[model samples]
Target: MNKIFFDNWESILRTLVITVLAYIALIAMLHTSGKRTLSKMNAFDFVITIALGSAFATVTLNKDVALADGALVFLLLIGLQYSITWLSVRYKPVKKLITSRPSLLLYKGEVLNDVLKKQRITIEEIYVAARKKGIGSLADIDAMILETAGEITVIANLTDDDSQTLQNVAKK
Candidate 1:
């Protein structure tokens, strides 16, 4: 019970020093990796972000995890992410394999029940996304898509006369 609240002063000091240094190292790594290192472009990018965060916490809090080891792991993950993204850009098949294509949830104010079911999305969720996009009614929506990053995108006030902007979103 006594040990639960009171760790030694030396341990606390060590944690503080390691935490500060790890934070600096992480910032430096992210800067070196470029802006896309932190972008939520797809599920893989999201995983990389989560892994970096986990590594940061481990390096800061786990005394067993050496700072040097943690830094190397961080760099490796960033490098792998960069490499994969580079290859994905040059190769369409790799891009398709690594990232999910955005799915159309609604087209022309009609709820695509089949698409919604396939995407595991509810109509209420679509309404919520529409509401967030400041859409007062379904009739005002042109398209609603579930992006690769699992975000809902709503394009509103579309009509038959308007140019089709959903060419990129995969239709079911």
Candidate 2:
């Protein structure tokens, strides 16, 4: 047992380094991903998160390391995540930088062509989001955003008559 502990020191240290790096990477990634990732946890999101966690675990603790090394990595990741969470809450600039706010998908009764191109999203995708929200035509949509995590958000500027029609469809 004692011999085993000494034999695996390098493996243990490597795992520590890898795990710290991985945790920081994840924190930065999630922070930049925006609130939609947290608020909108669908099936795809769940599966992807699980798969990523498994991969990160493997990268942090290869079989060369003992069980203790893996455990230490896990603990360090948790600690780093906690600290980052606290920091994000305490600092406004950090929160703004980390959490991307919603951008107008459409504004002033027009599809913002520049914004769509900036996101590298196709018009069809925005149209699809409008359709999901019961809009039939792009002409009716005023603004829309392809969220940071690839969720499409639609904004419609409707006249009183149009609002009544949409409200009817939305109720159904």
Q: Name the top lDDT candidate.
A: 1
- For residues 41-60, write the lDDT of model 1, one tens digit per residue: 68899888889899999988
Which 10 successive residues of model 1 have the least lDDT summed?
Answer: 157-166
> How many angstroms is residue 119 displaced in model 1 relative to the true structure, after the best TM-score fit?
1.0
- How well does model 2 score by local distance difference test? 0.61
* Per-model TM values vs. the true structure: 0.90, 0.54
Q: What is the lDDT, from 0 to 100, of the residue 152 in candidate 1?
A: 93
Model 1: CA > 4 A from native? 157-164
lDDT of 1 at 97: 87
C-alpha local distance difference test of each model: 0.87, 0.61
For model 2 the TM-score comes to: 0.54
Which pairs, if any, clash in model 1? none
lDDT of 2 by residue, 63-112 (tens): 66544554455455445544554676799876665555545556545677
